[model samples]
Target: MNQCLAKKVSLQILLVDSYDIALNATAQLVKTQYPDGNIISTRTANDAINKIVNWQPDLIIMDIYLPEKLGEIAQTKTGLDFLQQVMQKYPKLNIFVQSPYVKRLVQIKPAIVKHQGGFVIADKNVTSQEMLSIIDGALKGFTRIKGITDIYIYPDIYEKLNLKPEILKLLSLAFNEGLQDKAIAAHICVSERTVRKHWETLQAALGIDCHELRNQGINIRVFTKIRARAAGLID
Candidate 1:
């Protein structure tokens, strides 16, 4: 084993969620990976803010929706509100927000990006492997979360291209997995000929010529991914 892997580094992590079962289970899972790390769990945004201020954790894992009712007369504070506050107060803090709602992610992504902090939004149902990867990436200063491409694609560029929803989905699949036309057709329940048509439309719209790239030993699938990232379609 590498000496660094054998040695444990001390870290402090905070997990904020309204569900007690999920909160404790996530804490235990993280504890196993970071044996020397401290994990704190909180249900409400207020408690999370307090812990964040006092503990100064190295990473924070939060839910997009958190209970914020203080009383009948008190104004309710949302998880997004808390996130904005945290980002403004501690610009360099690492934060991971989980939610299954795509619309919510779309609404908050720009703000997170503008904050320029180590922040990532992940699906709530992420697998254990994906969860670990996201956490590791955040600690290493990566802002993009795995399997969430909609947030990466610039809406302005997408609109400028005037691509249909199906075309956008196809491009995302290609960029993410580099799937061949047949494989993509199978996944989308379409014929291979239809897939080729869509690919040709995308090439014409994006000004990419597959035949030209092939002559230079560059596969179109790989080139599409590179171009998407260059165009801010994928991070």
Candidate 2:
């Protein structure tokens, strides 16, 4: 939140999909094409919005038909409604809604502008690069070089530093940006001492000095995630 931090800020993109296959393919394409850009996706609209608020992504790639919960029963919600909320609160954020529900978007064009959200009405059949283009036009506002594929493709970077999931999650939570170790431990339902043991194992595997990995949680996390992605471990 520092002024200096804002000066060096990069564009963020959020992909919201209720379905995993569509979300993962889109995410992989986007991230593969533009690695430097902080592109992230979530299955839950709430979690999507949470990251949107925290990361302030310049664009949102959204889909319809969210799982719903009404008392004991679950219902459904539109991804557009979620987009509308983003527009209301973060009008500057651009959006590209990709759904088979193009007719609904045509019906609701008025709402799109009312919320000040941008649009790229995409069918389920749209190609990956076209989706990339929607994201491309928005990044210019952030003063980044357009259409240069800024995403970091460092599979070897992750490959060089292998780690397990439990340790990976802890590193992402605690090491990156110095999140509290106690909080990370609590989230994993383990003690701080146990977390340290995991760290020790990671240190041994990566050939990193224990003290260095302890301080560089984000780096450790990135390596772990890359390795996981390479191994296709994510669901």
Candidate 3:
């Protein structure tokens, strides 16, 4: 590879997080690895993306949720236009997009690949060194990983709420428009009361009163985003 292309191996990275502590933790983690690589940390994707445009980092590591702008939707740091620019100008650019929720990553994968980015498939329990190696591999032009993804649930919320693995499957069922509780219960092969009880537990765990969150938005589509933000997805 040419000097400029080889330099991309040590390319800087940007991180956009809505939650203060998570953003700082992630920035510090990256600094530990690439001590000299520019780490553009910000509170919003807009600012992060702008810095990406200027600094032109070879990679970006972003969590899905943010407030003020990213709000409930855990959008990519660089929106579609910026993604297009990345493909055009920095075809070798790497992106590691993560969320606390695996379902979110599954849903968002197509979009990530559209921008030529990859996912980290390791379980959250993996060591930080293992996770860093996943990121390094991506920068080196490998997209396939046998383990879990890098998107971690911010430790703040992760510690607060211990969600069951089944919740996401149940949520995927609930996100359907016009799906009644009875139908969801049937899908889960549980009684309606059981379904309601689980949903209640989910609401309580996230520290959001279900009725209140539901009151704010009638559309089921926003529930994924809402649950994520409620889980403190700033990192």
Candidate topping TM-score: 1
Q: If scored against the real structure, what TM-score would every candidate get?
A: 0.57, 0.50, 0.49
Q: What are the RMSD figures for all models against the true structure? A: 14.2, 19.4, 11.7
Q: Residues 1-235, candidate 2: write the lDDT tens digits.
A: 6866865675577887777798888878888877766778777767877798788777877775454322222112345456667777886677666665544332233455454445555666867777677666554432221111122233232332343447656655754445676787888998989877775665454444545756766566556544433332221
- For residues 1-235, what per-residue lDDT tens digits would candidate 1 score against the true structure? 5767644456889998877887988898888788888898988888889999998988998885677644322211366667778888988899887765433444344466766557776777888878888888888778874434554344544444444446655775676577777888888889989888887765655568888988998888767776665544443
Q: Candidate 2: where is the Cα deviation over 4 Å?
A: 1-7, 68-76, 115-117, 138-235
Whole-model Cα lDDT per candidate?
Answer: 0.71, 0.58, 0.56
What is the lDDT for 42 in model 3?
A: 74
TM-score sort, best first? 1, 2, 3
Count clashes in each candidate, considering only residues at least 3 apart in sequence or on different chains. Answer: 0, 10, 11
